[model samples]
Structure formats: C-alpha cells, structure tokens
Target: MKRVLVGIKRVVDYNVRVRVKPDGSGIALDGVKMSINPFDEIALEEALRIKERGAADEVVVASVGNADCQQQLRTALAMGADRALLVDTASAGGAPGGDLGLEPLTLARVLLALVQREQPFMVILGKQAIDDDNSQTGPMLAALWDRPQATFASKIELAGEKAIVTREVDQGLETLEVGLPAVFTTDLRLNEPRYVKLPDIMKAKRKPLDTLSLSSLGVSSRARVKAVRFEPPPQRQKGIRVKDAAELAAALKQKGLV
Candidate 1:
C-alpha cells in the first residue's frame, strides 16, 4: 500500500496580533489562540484527496512537540489521516536546547527518523509556519533524506510512481515531475482544507495516536541556531490626504520622494 506522510504544526492563529515578550525571550502566548498552521492544513488536505481518489492507500500525520501538539494531530485524524505520531522533544533528557520549540534542522532530523520507520512514498508539509515563517523544514528534510522535493506546490497530480507538481514562482507558475519518495511543501493556492464534521471528530478520538520520545530517534535535538529576541516591525507613519495632484506633487517634492 502506498503511504504518504503529512507534517502538522501548532502555531498562533494567523488572525491574531502577535507581540514580543517584554523579557526579550519569545513571542507571548499566555492566552493567544492557536491552530494548525494554515499551510500544513493545505498539505494534509492534498494528501487526503490523493487517498480518497485511490492514488494512495494511507495517509499518516506527524508532529514534533510537547503533549500540547496532540490537539493538532487529532484534528488531522479528524480530517482523514489514518493515524498520528507525536515525537515528544520536550521530555528529552540532556537535550541541547533550552526552548520547548524545535528548530527546523532538528525538526528535519526528527522527520528523517519517522520517514525511515514509516517508509512513506512521499512527505508533505506546509511551506512555512505562520509563527516563524522560516520556510526551511521541507527542503532540509529532503536534503537529509536525499530525496527530491517540490516547494511552494500550488497543484499536485500523482501518476504511477511520479508526481507532477505545479509551483508558484515569483515570475509565474512552473511545473515539475518528481519521483516517489519525495517531499512537497504546500502553498496558499492549494485546495482549501475540509472542515471536520462532528461525527468524524468523535471517531478521531478513538484513532491510534502513538507518542515517542526524541531520545528513541537517536537524533540530537541540539539547536544549530538560536533566536536572540523577538521584535515587532516598525510602525508605518500615518498618511495625509492632499487637496489635489498639484498639492500631492508639492508634498512629494518636499519629502524628496519625487
């Protein structure tokens, strides 16, 4: 049976206004709302579509984080993943990092272990996380696994053992064909994710969810990069309404913008 792996991440909801913590630590999350990263959601949706169409036999969803991430995994199950796996990095003893979050490189290492065990035909993940927007995990995972990858995938069609992926590039859309055992990072233009029905939510509660400690993977969680601090972007200056084109030209000349 062909299997596909989907990576899900819990992140601050895109609609929330993020703020840096006062202590120069990280972003504040005391009472902020959290959800599955939108891009990841799209990736999962594509995987489910493939399975439904009989192009794939099974879809597995995985996440790396503390126990709190189980909520997001359960959501993936509700959306139609056959099972879920959670790699608990928070409980690793003598881990190299102080933060609860795993860096992209560390995350790719964890995913590599999962890929070895599951032997999925393909792996799918969001192009970037809403919180960090690093957009590095997919490519890093592909490089680590020594497999082909297609990023920013706006469309995907699976053939016998190859995938035709349409990507959204800066200039325009570009399409490429990649063999099986590859990685794909989903973009915003992908299909919209389906909502979880109440019945499926109840069924998901009974689905298999396996949790493994990061130590078992034999991969170091030591972070290669560290976040020094979080800072919000500078606020934009207020705009003024000019009387007419002449006034606008005059103001532009005064500000040397012309």
Candidate 2:
C-alpha cells in the first residue's frame, strides 16, 4: 500500500504565552495548553491532500514523546490521518518524557526506525518544532535513512515514482524532483490545516493508536547534548523619545551609539 508518514509534535499552543520557570530549569508547562506543532499540522494536511487526490492510499501520523502526546496524535487522526503511532519515551531510563531533554538526532533515529518498519512512500515533518526550533530532524533522518529530502517545501506534487517539490530558499523558490520514498519538511506557505469537525473528533477516538517504546524501536532516548539552563530574554529598556535631531544626537552620544 502507498503510505505517507507524517510526524506531529506536541508543543505549547502557538497562541499560548510561553514562560520560563523560576529556577531556569525549563519552560513552565503547568496547565499550559498543548497542541500539534503548526508546521507538522501543515505536513499532515498535505499528506491528507495527497490521499484525497489519489496519489497516496493512507496517511499515518506519528509522534515521539510521553503518553500525554496521545492527545496531539488523536488530534492528528481527527485532522484525517488513517492511524497514529506514538513512540513512548516515558520509560527511557525512568526520566520524564516530553520534558525538553530529547535531542533531534535521537528523534531522527526514532523516525528512521518507523520508516523502516512502515516502508512508506514518503515521510513528512515540520521544518522545525516550535519548542526547540532546532530544524534538524528531517535532514538528519534523511541522511540516516539514505533517502532524498526536500526541506522547507512550500508545495509538492506527486508524479508516479517521483515527487516534485517547490522549496523556499534565500534567493527565492527552487523546484526539485525527487524519486519516491523521500522526506519532506513543510514550510509556512504550505496549505493551511483544516479545522477538525465535531464528527471527525468523535470518529478519531475510534481510530487505531498504537504505542511503541524507544527500546522496541532499537533507538535509545539518551540525550547527547544537555541543556545547561533556560533563561528568558532580558527585559527591554524603556525607549527615550527624542523631540529633535539634536536630542537624538545627544541620546545617541549618551548611549555610546554614535
């Protein structure tokens, strides 16, 4: 069967205001609303569109995190994925999962395992997860899996055993054609994800959601890079108004800007 695997991430909802804990340990998540990463949502939407267009037969959404991430996976199912897979990291060395310690390389390895198991025609993921914004997983996974990758894809079209992708670059949009069984990382301009209907939400609860452990996937959840600390940006100083060029010059001189 032709399948498309789309990866989703549980992150603080884009609308929520993120806050750091008092101890500089990490972002405070007490009661904060969590949702699927926006870019990944777009990726899922693209996969669904492909299925709708008859280019793909199924869309499978996957995530790597704690059990709480099941909530986000269900949301993906509601968004029209045929099934959901959760790589349960909660049991990894007894450390808490989904608490910002997992690195991108580990994530790539996990995805690589899923790709081998599922044998999907394509794998889709967001260009970056909002929490860490590392933007490294997709490329790393492609390298590890020895597959062609198209990153920052603004548009995609499937033609037989190849996919034509339009990606945004510093200069402008560049188009590339990659053979089947490739990786794609979505960009903002990719279609807007559809809102889940109440009926779809009800049906999603009945859809299959399978959970696998990192050990089961043969990928360790150990962190290669440790976060030393989390510090919020320093507060901005109040701006001084300059009534005239002389005042501006004086203010610039006073602040050593000149």
Candidate 3:
C-alpha cells in the first residue's frame, strides 16, 4: 500500500515539571500530565504531509506501552494517521521483573517486528523522546532491518523510490539521498503537528486501533538495561552579588577561576 509507518511515544508533557520519586525509583508519573512526545508529533506531521501530497498511500501510527498508550495512539489518529497500532506490553512480562519501561534496543526490536509484518516502504520516528532523550531507536531499527536511515532530518522530499533528506548537524546541514524502504528520524525543524479538531477527535474514535502482544510480534519486552535509580539534579548554588567588575574578578580569583 506504499505505507509510511510512524512511531509515537508517550512522554510526560514538556510543560510539566517532573519530580523524582521519594525512593528514587523513577520520575513521579502517577499524576503527571502525559502526551505524545513532541518530536514524534513532528514525525507524524511529516508523514501526514507526505500522504497528503500523494507520496504515500497510508499512514499508520504505532506505539509500545501499556493500555494508557492507546490514548496517545488515538491522539495520533486524531492528528491524521489513517490507523493506529499499540504493542500492549502490560500483559507481556516487561523488564527483569515486570517493569513497564522498555529500553531502546527492545523498542527497536518491536519496531523491527512491525516493519517485517507491515513491510512499509518507510518508517518515521522522533529523533529522541523527551523523557529518556536516548536517540538510539531509529538507528538501531535501521541496523536491525538492514535499511538505510536518515537521522535528525530537518527536511525531506520524495522522488519516485528515493528520498532526499536534509539533516541537522553541528557542522551545518548535511544532505543525503536514500532509496525507499528506509528509516527517518525527525528533527524540530520538521513541520509542526496539526491540532486535532473536535470533529477529527470524534472520528478517530472509530478509526482502526489494533492491539498486539509482545508474543505475537515475537519480540520480548524484557529490558536489556536496568535503571538503578533516578536522581534529581543538584540545586544550583545561590548567586552572590558583586558591586563591580573588580569585585567579581576578586571572587573569581578566590575561586581559582582567574
């Protein structure tokens, strides 16, 4: 169907001030506001645009998490994804002892399974998730699928079976052309996601949202990395006021900075 598979990740809303749990187990997500990862939203926006331009036939959004993740998936559908898929990890034993958090490698494996099943021409994902900020999934998926990948793509254009991607780099923007059946990770410069209108939200409810289990995908949810603990950044030291540059220089000298 010349489909474009887009990955969505559920993360604490960027607006929320995250708190470390009392026990340092993890960030307190119990009552935190959750939403689709902003980068992933950008990725979906690009995919939707591609479809709107008639370059792709279908846009399927997918996510890996508990049932709560469906909320974000439905939100993607509302954002214009034609269909949504949720890899339900709630029932499939997660981590070493059932921790719901999945590592980047595990996520790559899950996506690879989906890639094999769907055989989509292209896969799109956020360059990184806000919560973890480990920008590893896209590359890992490409390696596992043995497909070309263009990461941190600020712009993309399709021509027949090839894609020209403009990547954001420290050295400046770099461009590359890759054939179809590749992977792309979106950067912030990508198009902003469209707002989900009320009518679309209602229509999304009726869109196909299929649920799959880890077993069905032949991918294990067990995490490869164990999170020892979460620790908050140390509080910044109080700033001292100096009356003059000389005083500031003195202070700097006292601190061995000069």
lDDT of 3 at 20: 85
Off by over 4 Å in 2: 94-99, 241-258
Q: Model 2: which ten-residue window has the lowest total lDDT? A: 93-102
The numbered model that scores best in TM-score is 1
From the highest TM-score down, the ranking of the candidates is: 1, 3, 2
Pairing residues by index, what is the TM-score of model 3? 0.92
RMSD values, in order shown:
2.0, 2.6, 2.1
* lDDT of every model, 2 decimals: 0.91, 0.92, 0.91
lDDT of 2 at 3: 96
Model 3 misses residue 117 by how many Å? Answer: 1.5
Better of 2 and 3 by lDDT: 2
Over 108-210, each residue of candidate 3 has an lDDT whose tens digit, in order, gives 9999999988989999999999988889999999999999999999999998889999999999999999998999999999787899999999999999999
- Lowest-sum lDDT 10-residue window in model 3: 92-101
Model 3 misses residue 42 by how many Å? Answer: 0.3
Best by lDDT: 2
**Candidate numbers, best lDDT first, in rank order:** 2, 3, 1
